[model samples]
Target: MVDRTNADHDVLLTKEAEEQTKNNGLKKKMYKIAFVVQRYGLEINGGAEFLCRDVAEHLSKYCDIDVITTCAIDYVTWKNEYEAGETRINGVSVKRFPVDFPRETKRFDKCSEKVLCKTHSIDEEMEWMKLQGPYSTKLFKFIEDSKDQYDFFFFFTYLYCTTFFGLPLVADKAILVPAAHDEPPIYLSIFNDIFHKPKAIMYNTKEEKDFVIQKFRNGDIPHDVAGSGVSLSEKMESNNSHSLTRKESFITYMGRIDESKGCGELFDFFQRYKKENHSPIKLIMLGKTVMKIPTHQDIKYLGFVSEEEKYNTLQNCDVLIMPSKYESLSIVLLEAWLCKKPVLVNGQCEVLKGQCIRSNAGLWYENYEEFSECLNLLLADEHLRDQLGNEGRKFVDKHYSWETIERKYLDLIERV
Candidate 1:
């Protein structure tokens, strides 16, 4: 016997040690990430909320992700609309808390005018921030109590109470996805610490990053333009063209139908364009409307269609119109791109304009004349639309595919 007993003992011990090491490595790699947002639910169609949900769900495969949010469904009042408690939506754990008080629109509006429109003192600005409600103590309490549990925290949409208050408490561990735009809120000096204090920041586009840096000088902070993923149902790829099927040319508007989103201007422009041009193209409105859709035979309002339907409609349409002057990154633009469709954007939005220039995917309009010209041009030239759509798809493929985004996210988590 060539020392069989000793040989067996050595082999067993080696295997045990290797197993322990592997288990330890697995534990270390399994990051616990927390996503804090103001509102979340299936019914919520706002871009920020949707981005939060999609990212949380997708990242669940790589880490232990939990969503901390308020029970408010609507951003207007921040009323307790969703069930307040822990639940699992799309396989990710979510903890929802109640708002301390619902928002008084009139009071908040007055505060907004002073702080954003005119000027205000620090204390007054802070008061305005607090009045932008969903001031949930329990959420802060949870973060306070569970500081050691998560490796990192992501606060989405910088304009909310959850972000303003929660971000500072976890400043060392926070990664801000600001979803910011060049609005009056960005001018608030109160947000100086909010932008500069975070450990690292992520943005939706290069223009968003540039805008934030220009405003806050948070440029020194480690940040990148890690845009949201571009995903569409398979049905959209082979989408039916309305020109071939219905013999009608149409332009589709996606996103919230509200005055702030530049919907009123779009309607005015379209009404004038329709009356003057005598084109067969109809204007189709998608998503929830806050204002009454102008009653016209050529205008069609389809309330709150699912992403599948929206993308399907997107692929078939002559052009996609994003009229919003303020945008961080138009997910709708990316959606239109992925559907191999041309987009028409507000030239006033640098983010949108940047995307159009970078991708060469569509046109932008400054005035009704420009809008009418671009709309008519896109409708008239099928070959140009195809070329633009192809370029747009290439842009989306190069940057926003799931593989590219997931890798970027993992890199961020790894850095954290």
Candidate 2:
């Protein structure tokens, strides 16, 4: 078995010896593995991108990991923004390939609006997926060519071109982390081939696994629901009071700011709440804002804070809000739990609702009335907030700890 323990820092070694050690690790027969992703970099903020990076980093402690990906940084236009070559990121080797062409998002969206959520022929569905680019034929060719080099392969998020195309080429060694949701694209028949072909599927939640088994008819395929883990830093502690962490209490939203994520609804509800209740609750947004955010004195949009800043912000927040309806796994919610903050999620999201009910860590709302009521209730009862926050932290500690999730990953690889 690969070693998951951190080597002693007391052991002094030359630079040459360090490089040699990494090379020797890669040469080992059982642990050498490749992660095939459509995008891999520090800048990209997509959940799947973060998931791949986090899992790869954690697994590297136990295995020889290599990431093969496209040079594209932005999902909108799959342009080769980063140089196409090999590099090491946080001790993991990453090789990026050039995208053959940039994606036409306009064409994809226009067609997607018509075809997705509606029945269509296999040919039509395949065409829509192809148009959902980061269409890296070069990346696929690399996977096929280097099939013998790695003992195992991990493909993340089944919706993309890389997993959909590359999984079949190395199905015997493939493990897919589909990150599937109850969305329209998942209903496509093409996914059945991709889903069943993988040696095993790592789901983020039991709800996601259920969604897949229902749609893909993959009862026979070996699968496990293991979500991404939250690594506890020395600074992170069980403290959820806004008065202790920030100058003013605020409600925070962290994720891509888009209508699809229900940011518009969040802002509208907050506005209504602001007028109705005279409390000085400010709304702070962190991350990419894709839609027009209404300019409100109480609402502040701070784009992309550092990891340290994010944790501090979470500690200071009244509660974390997840407005998105389409989420296979809400990493942000897990982060909030680690920070000991209660959460409010969309009731429309079965996975989110399921998580809240299972953990007793937060509340979910189906409409604005419910949303406002939940928030007001959470705000009024400090004891209840503290209780929920404690429960969430306990839940995260129990199931989503790095050690637990990492063990699951290693087991999956061993079975493969």
Candidate 3:
């Protein structure tokens, strides 16, 4: 009888121990993910960096997220602007390492001119990459040592030094978000290795995925069009206080006010339109300015704005114009659509053109004449603008909802 009681007690204890273990396993994180980017911060609004942050924060709901980045804010100079260490941003852990050296713009440009315009060896191209850098050996060493800690590492933007060097270290567990567009640097021989090394690739758009596959012939690697999501508020209040006048019907441009973004062309076209047609239409620009703003009463530059102000201004605008000729995916375009607004984009950009075609939510133009015509048409017909804007909102709802985006990412992670 004593032996029987002792055996029963042992069985009960064993069952309790097994139950505790099962409970602990259930509470463990689904996966550990690390996002590696060139720059990261609340203030850093560069496309690739911002995309990385958004994706990381969103994914944090399901898994553990860590952002490995450089202490740089300025992309042109690669100047270390953040403290070198780990910190939490909106719940995700961020590890920032100091940039080994700041970029010399003249030297980088000289190197670029040589590499792109003239015959260059792989060695020369690699040198150019180092020059176009947020290079940090400490960051690389940390990645190497800690590779086993994370289930996967997502390296954002193939153009940067961080992705170029860091992705190869954990190629077996690397997922490359190559925010590549139709650009000259991608044709370089060094990129062939970068494209092929990743375990998988996440593209911003189908256009980008197709372009990369054609350029790099990297179709064998698993890839998906896992674009980032745009979260919309339940109610968006349109505040017209930021405008010069509440009654003015203005078109707005939001992004880096730099020449490369086709802002120069936009300024020229808008100024010409104002001159040719004595219309009261104004051009309101908001973002960090890198180029000189033309001195014209019709063109207003509202440097940088808050999120609420941005959406409010978007709601007030007659149209949103994205004049950039090169884009993998324009988040602002999505934002404009989310606000139920029509957009005018540069047709020369295949991604932008394709998006416009796919969604039927915006118009595109290759030249100034087309720009003027499209602008006039959209402004003249309120019904047409409403139709396009409604279609855009539908497109965004079907495709870019946070739930859909998160599912795609989670599915890819599971599959890969």
Best by TM-score: 3
**What TM-score number comes out for model 3?**
0.92
The C-alpha TM-scores of every prediction are 0.90, 0.90, 0.92
The 10 consecutive residues of candidate 1 with the worst lDDT sum are: 1-10
Candidate 2, residue 271: how far the Cα is off, in Å = 1.2
**Residue-wise lDDT of candidate 3 within 368-416, one digit each (tens)?**
8999999999999999999999999899989998767777777778778
What is the C-alpha lDDT profile of model 1 across 231-340, one tens digit per residue?
77565643443333235568889889999999999999999998898788888888998889989989988788766677668867889999998988888888889878
The runs of at least 3 residues in candidate 2 whose Cα sits more than 4 Å from the true structure, single-residue gaps closed, are 1-29, 117-119, 234-245
RMSD of each: 7.7, 5.3, 7.8
Task: Name the regions of candidate 3 deviating beyond 4 angstroms.
Answer: 1-29
lDDT tens per residue, model 2, 212-291: 89887897888788998896585444253233336777889998999989998899999999999988888989998778
- The best-first sequence of candidates by lDDT reads 3, 2, 1
- Give lDDT: candidate 1, residue 23: 52
**Would you list the C-alpha lDDT of every candidate in the order shown?**
0.83, 0.84, 0.87
What is the full ranking by TM-score, best candidate first?
3, 1, 2
TM-score, cand. 2: 0.90
Score candidate 3 by lDDT. 0.87
Number of colliding residue pairs in each model: 0, 0, 0
